[model samples]
Target: MKKVIVGNHAVSWGVQLARTEVISAYPITPQTQVVEQLSEMCASGELNARFIKVESEHSAMAACMGASAAGARAFTATSSQGLALMHELLHWAAGARHPIVMADINRSLGPGWNIWTEQTDSLAQRDTGWVQLYCETNQEVLDTTIMSFRLAEQVNLPVMLVLDAFYLSHTAEPVDIPDRELVDAFLPKRQARLKLDTAEPHSFNALVPPASYMEMRHALQEAMREARTAFDEVEEEWEQRFGRRYGAVEAYHTDDADLVLVTSGTVTSTARHVIDQRRAAGERVGLVKIKMFRPFPTETLRAALAGIARVAVLDRNLSPGRGGIFAEELRAALYDVPAEDRPQVYGYVLGLGGRDIRPDTIDTVIERTRAAAAPDREDLWVGLLGDDGAPATTGRAQTSADSLPGVEA
Candidate 1:
């Protein structure tokens, strides 16, 4: 049935349908509703599950790891700081090869304190060896939630799907809540390939000698490589039954285009409008929306941008001294492509801390990319304060009401 619901509820619905046996989470902005709804489901008997009200994000993840290792389907949810707290256990779950699924509502990290959207938190954990899938809409959130479980179990790696703070987490949209029978058929009971069996005691995560550590790490890497194709097959099976399919990377009209705009999360929606408007004006421009970040879709990206002359990567998250993380990865991914075939990729950072990413902001990125003499590795701030963090006297630095829509000085 199709009903209008916020992204958080969509996640809860997906979890319920997947028949998650264990859920452990601590409340944080935007992500609180997801756990709250799940708790209610558990209490009301609509969902048969164990809802663990853990003390902190770390404990929540630890509980999930334990439950998952005990041969149960486990899950959790969190935001910026909450996600940061779980960083330690994030590695544990991946290293143990536990198929735990988590929903991270992307929010800003701060000294000044803000609970708005930013991808920095999850991106910071890039080296943690977890599968990351970023969703662009509420519907995608629900569908991805269900599919993530299948993918995680298939590869024996934890999966984390991200949603923009308020744009996605708090907003409402129509979502097709999959029928119980369909979801059951799609994602049935998980029979652990390995588990904590009391009858057959075995050491898990025990001390490993230096000689054996490298081999274990290599095996995990091999699984990650296999996940790339496993993810494709999972989604293909989903499309066959559900009539909807979103690839690891999604391309919008890149065919024979000279310039392309790259984005993830909600920004992709706005970029699509910009692309449509530009196309009407007879411009050879396109948009590429990345859904799966980890198992980084190298070959998929190469094919989408193979012949393009220039590409603009707009990142809402930053790496401080380094440029946008996504841009850095793209540069490396395209490095081996023949020099003449690789496009000059520009990285633009914008819309941090829940600030809206309007179509005008995206337009500026494309304009700058077209004018730049060479690919800029340094991150360029798209919406900076009017000069010195005060009112701008003129030009693009103007921090006037018109300059910052819905922003109060």
Candidate 2:
């Protein structure tokens, strides 16, 4: 069935179709609609699930952990500050190897008090051992939500699928809602390998002393490695059944291109239009959209960009004193490649605090990357505004060459 829906409702539809057994969340802007719809589903008997009412985001995750521990298919949704509040339990959910699925609407952290889209919130939780996937469209949001449950259960690790706030959360799009029977066939009842069973009562998440702590950590790392491969298997099955597939790292026009832009989430859609324009003009520009942030898709990235002349990573999230989070990680991932094959990575930070990253903004990035001998600095701020609301120079230096013109910062 096809229906026009916002991204949050797409998430709700996906969770409902997945036959999730437990739903727990605290309402936050952008993400509230996700759980709100699920609550209605549960309340109206459309979805037979326990909708746990939690007072806080931390408590919401705690409730999900408890439900998942009992071998139930659990789910939740949250945004920015709410996600930050659940930090501690995120680690617990992953450490205990619970296959709970979550939908995180990416919103900027507060102070100046904005509630617009940004990737920093979800990227901040990169090391929490959860498999992270960023969606570019509402359809992908719905599909990934269902696939996440299968991927998490297969690897026994929590999964978080992220979508941009307002851009996706509130913007309506036509989505093909999969048949409930098909989703059920694809993701049958989750059979947890280990759970808190009444008949077989046993210790769960007990203290690990120095003797075994390191090994347990190693096991978690191993599971992450396993997830990188399992995700492919899951996508493969999903594609076979549904005739739709979005790669963990999708490369476009890169086979014979000299420069390729790296992007994620909604920014990817914009970059694609620019790439198409550049291609039509006979310029060898391409794009790589990264969907899976965790399990990093290192091998796939290497295969796609090994011999590319220059690679520009446009990150909507910053790592404070460092640089763009995705660029930093991509640089590290490319470090081991043969010096001759590695592309010079230029990191451009933009669109933070929900700032617009338009086509001309991307055009500026491509022009600067192609003209520069090497990156002037690690983090090149794009579309920045000055104190008087004039176009500001790049973050590193305020030179005429660094000034961004005809672009919205």
Candidate 3:
């Protein structure tokens, strides 16, 4: 059935269809609606699940970890500060190899306290050993939510479905709410390959000796590496049944193009409109929508952007003095390729804190990026809205870089 739904509500519908057995969440802007709707469904007997109203985002994730470990299909939703609060349990859930699926309405972090869209929260945790999916529309949010469980369970890794806080979270759009029977057929019963709960007692979360700690960590890394194939298989199965397929990084109009724009979340939709307009006016610009952030799809990115002479990466999240978040990752993804072969990536930061990004603004970024391709040229800033709109900062600096490395770009 088709209905106008916000991204968060679409996620709730997906969770309901997936037959989630347990849901734990704490209220936060944008993400609050997801849990709220799910709670209503459970209360009204529309969905059969244990709805846990936890004290904080930290406890919400802890409860999910506990439930999933006990052999239940667990779920949760959060945003910005809430996500940051769950950082500790994020590692615990993955290390326990619990297949918990979560929806994160991406919002900016702050000292001034703002509630709006930005990828920094989720992107900051890129190495927590969880699969991350960035959705471009309400429909993708629904589809990705259902597929996340299959992919996460296959490799025993949790998956975080990240969407722009207000852009997608609050906007209404038509989405095909798949029949429950079809969802059941596609993502049936929840089964954990290895579980902590047992009819026969066994030790779990035991202390690991220093000699074996690194090896156990390596094992988890191997599982994440294997999840790449697991994700592909899940998407293949989904496409076979639903007639829709999304890649680790979805490419648009890249064929025979001189420049490509890379984006995530709802901005990709705006970028697409800009690309189409430019193409109509004879500009050879295209778009690359990055769905997976962690287990960073480097090889796939290299291939999609291999031939393009110039590429522009627009990030909503500011890394303080370092410019856009996604720009750095794209740079690292193509760093090893020969300078001539690697596309010249230009970074532009825009649309933080619920600010609107009209198609013309995106077009302006593309135009300016083309004009400033030289190595010495500074990073670009689009739609800065005020005098604070300084030229974009580039390369990692002490003030901007996170203490933990391996984030790549």
Candidate 4:
């Protein structure tokens, strides 16, 4: 069936179709609607699941861990500080090998006390040993939510599906909601390989001494590696059934282009429009959209951008004192490529705290990248304002949303 739904509801529908046995999540901006809808489904008997009401996000994740360990397919949703609060248990969930699926609405962290979109929250959890997938559209959000459960269960690792806050979480779009029967056929009830059993009570996550600690860590790494391949196989089957497929890294118009812009989340939509315009004008520009972050698609990225003259990465999140998270990772990934095949990487940090990344903003980035003789080690800041709230002099021309039709300021 086809329905018009917001991204949060898309997540709710996906969880419902997956037939998740347990749901636990505390209310947080942008993410609250996801759990709210699921709670309603549970109450109305639309979804036969246990909705655990927890006092905090930390407790919510704890409940999910327990439920998942007990052989139930569990799920949850959170954002920004809520995600930060679950930090400790995130490791426990991954270390204990619980296949819990979570939806993280990308929201900016507070200090300035703002409830807007940003990528820092999720990017900060990069070392927690969970698979992360970023989505661009409501349809992709729904599709990825179901696929995540299958991927997580197969590899025994947690999976997080991330979407932009207001851009996707609040905005409604037409989505093709798959039939429950079809979803059931794709993802049957999860059969845990090793689950807590009352009849055979066995302790899990016992104290690990140095004698065998490294090996356990190594095993986790191996599972992460396995997830990289498992995700591809999972997507292939999904495409065969639904006739839709989204790769970890999707390349567009890069066959003979000199520069390719790399982006993620909603920014990719704006970038695509600009790429189409540039291609029409014969500018030799292309684009690459990265959906999968964890189990970083290093090989796929290398193949897509190895011989390009220049590759610019637009990061919506930042790592203070360092630079853009994605940019730094991309540089490291491309570091070992032969000098001849290595593309000079230009990193630009923008859209932090929900600032609008307009078409003109991307246009400026392209012009600056093409003009630069050498890529800078540090990322350039776009759409920044000075003390007077005037656009800062960042070598980017000031442009408005009105410059392009169908683009809102």
Candidate 5:
């Protein structure tokens, strides 16, 4: 059914249709509405599931861990400090191989206690051993949530579905909610290939000697590598049923473009608009939207970026000393490609703390990147100011190791 719905509600419906057997969460804006809607659905008998009202985000995840360990498909949602609170459990969920899926509304971390959009909160947990997917729209949110479950369960890892807090979470848009019957056909009951079955009487979180610890870590790494294809196949089946296709990355207008822009979450939508407008004016520009963050889609990114003259990476999150988080990842992804196949890359840190990124700003980023294609230059930061009132540009070869705090490179 087609309806105007906010991103959070869209995700809520996705969870509903997925028939999640367990949900545990605490209220934290702008993510609070997601849990609220699910709570109402549970109370009204619209969703037949166990809704555990926990006192805090930490407890919420703890409850989810218990539920998932008990052989139920589990889920949760939070942002910023709430996500921070759930930190220890985040590692537990992934390490336990519980197949728990979560929705993290990307909000800025605060010194002044702010609740606004930023990518730092999610990026901070990059090493937590979870498969992360960043959504560009409400439709993507709905679709990715379903795909996340399939991927997580297949690899026995957790998945984090991330979207911009206010930009996509609160904003309403036209979304096609897939029929419940169709979703049921696609994702049936959560039958575990390797679940904590009390009947089987197995010990999870078992103590391991040093002899097996390294091998266990290696096994987890192998599973993550194998999950890429598993993720692709799940989406293929979903697209065949829903008439929409998604993957680790989605490229737009890149076939014949000289310049490309890469981003995640809601910024991809803004970048797409600018690409379309510029295409109308005869500019050869395109965009690449990264949906999967970890299990880093390295080869896919390299293939998409190959042959482009220049590429601009606009990240709403910072790596503190480094300019843009996504940009740094992109450079790493392209390391193995021949130097000529590599494009001149520009990095921009914008939209942090709910800062606005107008279409003109996107256009300016692309234009500047194309103009600054010096062979020796390695990195440039657009839309950020330097100490001397200049646009921020750093040598691409340097990794911001010596960067000072509050200073743009």
Candidate 6:
């Protein structure tokens, strides 16, 4: 079925089609609609699932954990502080291998309490064992949500499908909703081999001695590695059924390109426009959109970026003193590539706290990359407020949404 729907509703639809048995989530801005729609579906019997309206996000995840342990396929959605609050249980879900698929509408963290999009919330949970997939469009959000359940259950690791707060979540777009029967065939009910079966009363998740702990960690690492390939297969099957697929990492127009821009989330859309503009005028520029963030796709990224002279990594989320999260990971992924064959990856942090990442801002970054020597991996906060709370640099106003270049206050 084709419908024009907001990203949150698309996610709700995906969860419904996946036949998630237990849907639990607490309301938070940008993510509330997802919970609301699910609740409505549950109440109206439109979805034959148990919708647990938890008091908080932490409890929401806890409910999912319990439900999944009881051999039910589980799911949830959250953003920003809600996700932050669920941090501890995020580990529990991944550690216990719950296969709980979550939709994190990326929102800015708050001390002053802003409710806009930012990747920091999800990026901060990198240490947790969840397989993270960032979506670039409403359609992708819907599709990734369904694929995530398959990926998560296959590896028994949680999967976080992320989208920008307003850009994807609030923004409505034409989406092709897959048929429930097709989805049922694609994602059958999760069969948890090690679920909490009452018949086989046995200890699960008990404290392990040091001798058993490291090996346990290794197992998770192994599963994550396996998940990378499993995810590919899942997408391949999805393509066969739906005729649309975005691989774990998508590269655009990289052949014979000297410069390639690396991006994730909705920034990829904006970056695509910039790349096209630059490419038309005889600029050898390309783009690599990272969809999967976990298990890092080190080799995949290395292969895509190989032979390119310069790669500019656009990080929408900062790790504060450490620099941009994606940039750090990319450099690490590309670290083993022989220096002569390696791309000099300049990491630029832009559009924190939901500030619009303008096409010109990306243009400025590209120009800066062209003019610069090898970056020391220092994060350049492009168009961010200076110490005096002013626009850092002014290059050109490329569009009406261009909040870059001479940003006023």
lDDT of 2 at 264: 97
C-alpha RMSD by candidate, in order:
4.1, 2.0, 5.3, 4.4, 3.8, 4.1
Q: TM-score, each model? A: 0.95, 0.97, 0.92, 0.96, 0.92, 0.95
Query: Model 6: per-residue lDDT, tens digit, 1-409?
Result: 8999999999999999998899888999989999899988888988899988889999999999999998898999999999999999998888888899999999999988988888999999998999999999999999999999998889999999999999999999999999899999999988888878879886778999999988988999999999999999999999999999998899999988999999999999999999998889989999999999997898899999999999999998988778889999998888889878899888887888888899888988887777666664366667866567666663222221334345322
> Per-residue CA lDDT of candidate 5, range 235-342, in tens?
899889998876799899999999999989888888898999999999899999999998899888888999897888888887776667888898878877888888
In model 5, state the lDDT of residue 111: 80
lDDT of 2 by residue, 1-409 (tens): 9999999999999999999999999999989999889989999999999999899999999999999999999999999999999999999999999999999999999887889999999999999989999999999999999999999999999999999999899999999999988999999998988789988898999988999988988999999999999999999999999988899999999999999999999999999999999999999999999999998999999999999989999999989888799999999999999989999998899999999999988988899788776765556888788667876544453232543443222
- lDDT (Cα, tens digit) per residue for candidate 4, span 1-409: 8999999999999999999999998999989999999999999999999999899999999999999999999999999999999999999999999999999999999989778899999999999999999999999999999999999999999999999999999999999999999999999999998899988898999999999999999999999999999999999999999989889999999999899999999999999999999999988999999999999999999999999999999999999987789999999999999999899998888988999999988997887788667676568777777556776534332232222222212
Query: Highest TM-score: which candidate?
Result: 2
Which pairs clash inside model 4? Answer: none
Give the Å error, residue 137, model 3.
0.7
Model 6 per-residue lDDT at 315: 90
Query: How many residue pairs clash (N, CA or C atoms closer than 3 angstroms) in each of the candidate models, in the order given?
Result: 0, 1, 2, 0, 2, 0
Residue 262's lDDT in candidate 3 = 93
**What TM-score should be assigned to candidate 3?**
0.92
Root mean square deviation (Cα) for candidate 6 = 4.1
Q: Candidate 1 regions off by >4 Å?
A: 388-409
lDDT scores for all predictions? 0.89, 0.92, 0.85, 0.92, 0.84, 0.89
What lDDT does model 2 reach? 0.92
Q: Total clashes, candidate 1?
A: 0
Q: Could you tell me which residue pairs clash in candidate 2? A: 383-409
